[model samples]
Target: MTLQNQSGTSTIRPTIDTMDLEEIVELRTSHMVVGGAALARDANGRVVFVSGALPDELVMVRMVTAKKDFATAEVVSVTEPSASRVEPACEAWHRGCGGCDWQHIAPAAQVAMKTDMVREALSRTARVDQPVVVTGAAIAPWGYRTTVRLAVGDDGRVGFRSRRSHDVVALRACPVADERINGLLATVVAAGTDELSLRVGVAGAELIAWGAPGALVSGLADTVRIGATAVVHEDVAGHRFRVSATSFFQSSPEAAELLVAAVTRAAAGLDLGQCTVIDAYGGVGLFAATVARGAERVVLVEASASACADARHNLRGQRAEVMEMRLEAWTPIAADLVIADPARNGLDKSAAARLVQTGASRIVLVSCDAGSLARDTRLLREHGYAHRGTEVLDVFPNTSHVETVTRFDRFAPGDRANHPDHV
Candidate 1:
């Protein structure tokens, strides 16, 4: 068969005719996928997705599932290991703990691949042609997670879920988690709970037991709550913010500060005096508190009551208003800048429409899901929003999750006049 290559030249492609199905073959992993798998192409030119393999490594892989265009495989042996390959710090990694998929990869390599992954996602999903610049990749990738949730079996064993399976992988310590969590995990055995969440920050470690409400049995954390609600204070970029056990917060405090800095940098050229800045889906007012100091009015709109309460406390001294409403339901307010940090589901149709219709001068979006971010970006472009730039942050190290902050500015009046839906 003939196909157009990257250079736009028609080239003859070869297919594997003699290759046996499910046979073990040596393959070279050329790149890392968004989901933490290494990608390779077989002699037949079929794409192979291999787990536990690093880029530029030649490994023996046994095909688990095969189709006409692609196959999924498991690494049987690494015949040639990449320079970035390293021994995983966690013993539970081999047993299928899904928390740290890139643990076997060197820290620097992991950051490089993560940045590439974000760029690829934007180009493929959002049709963005500009190059993506990712920051905060090498800033203490390990021991950075300030919060982690552990599952509990019926027998009161605390651990994490296996990769793509419900099975629990017992863990004595998680190296990526904050040192405080590791210390707490070391002490907690047979806590007789169904689930445990550990968070450590400026306030110290806090534990929230999910099952069997009872009094604190140990001095594992600074504060302990029986259920899923506990107050945790976090210090980011020299600012203090209140975070709840159930509220969403960045796993890495240093990375969170980097993300905030990215947002502030995106807004540096814009004037904010006597103007309003809306922080949509603002969990615990992290963005609102940081940006409130510069704007005359900082409006925080959130859906969770617990988070809104925390925001009220966190933004007390600033000129901020905490609105407990979903992004879609909140009335569009006049603002100079709007920053939305939605969940993995991203901005829905209603929220996207509001963003385009809000008439904000600048919009900064912080998204964790690439597909959702791309979809929203496309929607904004359709409504005459020009793509400014994007910065990717490695918030969750050794895993597939990466935090991306994208900036957009409304197009000029002439450009908007040519838009099909322009009013």
Candidate 2:
């Protein structure tokens, strides 16, 4: 049947009832998408997504699946290459190793693409036309990831999962992972477990073996344990954070500091000496601890017990208070500012409404997903908050994930004086 695409192009599409399911097609890639797929238009004007190909390149693709308007393919060969394309740093790049998708793209080009993606998301989704301010690319893109979880296959191969598949690709080392983490791969393989995690910091490396007996633990790192649980200490900005296997911590120490600095800059101009601040979804109190020096009273709201405990430990001598509850369950306290760094899902809808109810004059939202950031930005806009500005940080280099810090100011003036019920 003939169809018109979003780009105002007319073409023919084969029906599922009559189309040759095993047909191969040639695709000239146009651009990259989230999750590292190179998007191209097929002969019939239908979208085709293929991996291991760069934009402005001609690739022979083996169609794996076909849908009504689009198809998914795997690159069989690259007939042409882009100037920004480079040989993948990892030998496992084309082997379906899903760890680093943009490893084939130049580091500078990757950062530029991420910046454009964030800016486009804000412009198209959040209705913000302002140019996004992006931080410079990482000085050391390779060997910067402080933590990584390696999946173990049934055959005892330790590596990462395949892109959009359950298949595990074995690896000797990951270029994006820290050298210390790569150094423990041998120990992880010896643990004889289904999965394992390695975390490295100033204190040293810690290994967490999943579904393995505690007896498997040895001198792989300074601290090693089994049962998929253990806390690793990370020193950031003069503060120490005890991060567990499940707790969230920035993978790159340098980028984490940059994020904290962005948060601090966005939260400036408040009466920090006497004003109260809330760190919503404050995993391990990264923001709370960093901003606590200026905040007279800081309340950290986290749902993870382990993360809350870590926050409590991290903020022991500071003036911050830890609340071990979800943002939706925690009672709203009047404050001068609220800083939320939620997961990829962004803020809960109910809790976002409640955040508006808190009547904080300033709110800083730090997010990893641009789509969620845009969604939550619109939610706050509907509640009478003005989007001041945003700064994008290239924390996760060589990947589509982008981190953004957006500040919003409430339009309706609220009382800045201390309230008796305010924490």
Candidate 3:
């Protein structure tokens, strides 16, 4: 959601050699890779990942990073551009706002690229030969975001950070943000803080800042809530969810509804009414409060205390229990069903093994990263769980991110543990 595919470098910087950094190389990209970059090879047959370019396009690139295994480069110019290339719709993008990565690509092409990315990840990493399809959103791509975080500069100007740097790119408007959010840009007060958060909740527009509002914000102080608001309510699929400031929620209500329908569809035939559902890595009990509501009993495990509190409130009076703990650290209780939504790195070996230990026959997994999804799929397969199917949705349009909902069924023959006593 270009999420919000950002490239970060954790590796230590190597002492630069002037010759390599100064050399400009031209290469034709073969295809898009996992991290929203185009794959190509230089004259020396070295793998080169080119940013800001598309497949089958010849671009002149300059090396920005040099590693023994591979290198990353920035596009100096596109010698031959793909037909899918389009002028980015936002002035912020042209001003070097790193909010999106696929802004230069056509919308339809963006979906196609994300689909191919999922298929390739599964095939290369999970060893699955199944067809992958990603459904595009029905609503217009622009003005869908209900949440936006801005970085404040030394000059008190607020906007998004630049691409591949910590510098800020001041903005007057953001194209992808909801129209209401864009309206707050002029009135937003960035005083006394380096970061600001804006959101559209059921109560209305909210501006989250740590301290008291100054005269800069006094202009709209009566209109917008510009203080520490405990929880914001959002209506999704006929349900209102109490979301904390730090809770993980979908970018917009529409995206949340789309994801909810996808998860419910993936869990079909489970007859959740009579089953014990475990919402692993649950944040604010989104799945538990909605799709898993009718389950006989529900247990939600989360790492964030704030989310746990919100989950308890969101799932109040229901047969739901909120456990504040990390997924890998939680002790498993035998259940009939499970829903796991781990972070981008996916479940580590220990975490995946713990999930398998739950002995839940029906499991639904939500993944935001393709590589992690493929790896976790392989790990689950090794634990006697068969990959039933996967559904992907482009909830975040105009970005390189896609939400994947996958189902797994434990099919260990003659294994009593796979079927809990409740079943």
Candidate 4:
């Protein structure tokens, strides 16, 4: 079957009978695929990929491309909804801004799905049978995001890209944005001339608007500082943080507090008090200072020189040694605990292997991307570390991204004999 769009583009449509007969398979082992939602297999037994559908959803899909080994389809309908499915909160999500995913799933279900994805990635990719627990977010799902970037449309209106395409999607307001940002958006949109992009930051219900040329517009109260440390806010974890427009800090203060607490708790069981500790990818030293409270000596490894300078200011009085070097080049000293909160890429193979080689008694990995976490965890397990446990933190709500804290203990072949069921 074939369906044509208004633009005269043709798409192959899958038969309803075939969709109804296809077996249910889990996408990324998190989302279930059923009915027309599942891609049809050719006579050669190669599976196809379907979009805009969820698990248990009976969709009548239109195949857009069919290669020799695989195919791609677009969903037409869903006869049944997955138990986890829910109405998407953001109407602009389907337009493909690349900002949020999993908006159609319930918040609780999203967390659970992320937890399962982490566990499966560990077991299959890392070959560890470790148990995982999911945790709730620190703040409300909607209106919790404090920062957002929007592309300026050709029509002089700021908008976001469509869900899966570069085409701009017109948006009057963003639901996930804080009310303060929305208010600022109104003013910006009203006074717009031809700005290519707009970046807004919200702090405690006050909005600070920055134009494409990096000039402040309005809605800021005053610059808050702690001693020489100057930021939009002074208080973070009972200490002052020197934050700026470019400096990386967690947008949600509430969520940041919860995440910091979780990381602190995860490190409590490990004896970092007397041993040297390395906080790799330590941005602004938020976690470094928190973890340093317990560690006798802490070494923060960062690649960004500017962030390291900020770290120096943030950790002025704290007993921490800052090393401005990449994680790959920096030599690893044996430590009690190593906390790594890397970017979305997680840890490269070299860094992951190096951490294992350091022989750190315990490793706490904080990741925003589950797939990368799973891949790194598997790498660690292969290098003689036993997965202790994993906890999912819903840092970014109303979106598919999840923060996870995974603990690992260095293991020897005969060590498990003393402690059975360790893995």
Q: Best-fitting candidate, measured by lDDT?
A: 3
Residue 100 accuracy (lDDT) in model 2: 85
Deviating ranges (above 4 Å) for candidate 1: 1-23, 67-69, 189-194, 204-225, 416-423
Provide the lDDT at 142 for model 4.
81
Q: Could you tell me the lDDT of residue 86 within candidate 4?
A: 74
CA shift at 103, candidate 1, in angstroms? 0.5
RMSD of each: 5.1, 5.6, 7.3, 6.8
Q: Is candidate 2 or candidate 4 better by lDDT?
A: 2
How do the predictions measure up, each by TM-score? 0.86, 0.85, 0.87, 0.78
* Regions more than 4 Å wrong, model 2: 1-22, 130-139, 190-193, 204-229, 413-423
Give the runs in model 3 whose Cα sits over 4 Å from its true position. Answer: 1-19, 131-139, 202-220, 413-423
Error of 2 at 202 (Å): 2.1
lDDT string, candidate 3, 1-423, tens digits: 011101232422222232377567667798987888888875445687889989999887888887766788888888789999998988888878898888999877776787677878887888865634455443357888877878877776778999978899987678888877777776565677777777767444444433333313333445566654545788877777887766777888888888788889889998888899999999988899888989999999999988998899999889999999998788999999999988888889898888888899878999998889889888887887767777777777777877788888888676755421113
**List of clashing residue pairs for candidate 2:** none
Measured by TM-score, how close is model 1 to the native structure?
Answer: 0.86
TM-score of 2: 0.85
lDDT of 1 at 340: 88
Q: Output the worst ten-in-a-row residue range by lDDT, candidate 4.
A: 27-36
For all candidates, the clash counts are: 0, 0, 2, 9
Measured on C-alpha atoms, candidate 1 has an lDDT of 0.76
Q: For model 2, how does the per-residue alpha-carbon lDDT over 1-423 read when each residue is reduced to its tens digit?
A: 676533346756553335676665566888766545778877666788887777788876677788888878877777777888887778787787888877878887876676666666677777864634565445367888887777877766579998769889988788888776777765555345666666765454554544455424344554555454566777677777787767888976687788888888888888788888889999988988886567889999999998888888888888889999988888898988999998898986798987888889989999888788878888887787777777877788887788888888887535333221112
